[model samples]
Target: MSKVKKRIRPTKEQAQELNRRLDAVVEAGHTSNLYCDCDVCQALAEQAKLMGYRTDVTIKRPSDKWDRRKREYERRRQNDAVKMASLAGQGLTSAEIGGKMHRSKSYINKLAKEFEITLATKKRGRKLCH
Candidate 1:
């Protein structure tokens, strides 16, 4: 049998701060322009990356392309689903949520499924380390 690498769960304080950063970005429909050099911020950056989360620290708020900007306006529902999907449940479908949000059905469905895997309660399947 192979082993699944254990993911490091963030500290409560860390989660709070990361939540703050995310809320700030979403509320403004823009990324932050400054990187918070606080120790908690750095730890989050490292841990999220280590866990295969692709994230960018806001050293400067980068301007978004047109589509990106449009999506930002539409992000509220997706963001809500993101939180919901992260919870342990039967989970919702993209098309169901999409109709409510007026988003592309395919995209939302894909996200719902992906989030299910990533936030899965089950352990990851292991592969042979050749």
Candidate 2:
């Protein structure tokens, strides 16, 4: 003969108490059609567990892929700008700098403008004979 285990259930008073706790946390998000797992919800979950009440936790979130990609793109652009400025300061022409970085001279010029970097060899006056 196989033995079946009986499940423990909360008494009526315990049920009411657990319901009150859950209500306090869930009602805050009722207007927005969302339920957050904030501190209040966490406390409610803990209280329900202590009272032997079965609980289900659910969380919903929007996709962050676009936000993450935008952040990464910005970071890379800043790093590239810094590198372009460093190369320009080292007396490398835009074409040489672009070739070294596997980019076009125009793109290097664009980065230079964006970073407000002055090219080292772009003097406007008459050429010196040294």
Clashes of 1: 1
**Model 1 steric clash pairs:** 33-61
Q: Give lDDT: candidate 2, residue 75.
A: 99
Q: Mind giving the per-residue lDDT tens digits that candidate 1 earns over 1-130?
A: 8996666776787677667766655565544534455554555566556444645543344466866878985696568666556442444445545555576766665666755533233336997899
Q: Which stretches of candidate 1 lie over 4 Å from their true place?
A: 31-47, 50-130
TM-score of each: 0.26, 0.44
Lowest summed lDDT across 10 adjacent residues in model 1 is found at 114-123
Q: Give the TM-score of candidate 2.
A: 0.44
lDDT per prediction? 0.57, 0.75
Clashes of each: 1, 0
**Which ten residues in a row are the worst by lDDT in model 2?**
52-61
- Give me the runs in candidate 2 sitting further than 4 Å from their true place: 1-62, 120-130
